[model samples]
Target: VVGAVVSITGVSSTVTSFGTTVRSDLVLQNENHMFLDISLWSDIARNLNGQELAVLGRSGPVMLAVCSLRVTGATKGGYSLTSTPGTRCVLNPVSEMAHLVQS
Candidate 1:
């Protein structure tokens, strides 16, 4: 899915039986104004913390192209998207769809 970045939450950590788990919520909105929350896990979440994220959207709403996502039921209701190991994200993608979303 390709959408405009609305906001990204600060990285949060949780302790599980495996070990410490890190995640961040990246909220994106499509041209139709529908919102989707994608959970970015591990290194992907850590890399966007603090200043890095600000830089990404400093110019304008960051355009994102996300692939290989997993659909899961949200806690409150409905469904939310989650990043899988194969998930790939591209910022400011130079495509017609991205341009439409940007405008």
Candidate 2:
């Protein structure tokens, strides 16, 4: 499905992967009509928001996909897939990624 850019938001972090924890805010966003939201790490936060992003999610029998997004806020919303909001990087499915790039 195709969705327009909506908004990007920032969020706070309490720990890092290396165990060297630090508190920081990162940017995230919701795509067009998707119930899920996307967030980027501090290193890429600035470049992520308000940018068109392609996303994909999968389970045993369910698959979710989205294209184009607008990062919006700083607070964590209910749409996150990770335990910590805006901390983990979301991966787009390879098939969806190929579809997105080809279009």
Which candidate number has the best TM-score? 1
Model 2 segments beyond 4 Å from truth? 12-14, 17-35, 39-42, 46-98, 101-103
lDDT string for model 2 (1-103, tens) is 2233233343443235675433334343335434434333444443333332332222211122222223333345634233344232333334444454343
Q: Which residue pairs does candidate 2 place in steric collision? A: 7-70, 7-71, 7-72, 8-71, 8-72, 8-73, 9-72, 9-73, 10-73, 10-74
- Give lDDT tens digits, candidate 1, residues 1-103: 4444444444333323366555555554434344545555556564655346546744554543333344343345666555645444544345644545432
Local lDDT at 42 for model 2? 40
All candidates' lDDT scores? 0.47, 0.35
Off by over 4 Å in 1: 9-19, 57-85, 96-103
- TM-score of candidate 2 versus the correct structure, residues matched by position: 0.26
How well does model 2 score by local distance difference test?
Answer: 0.35
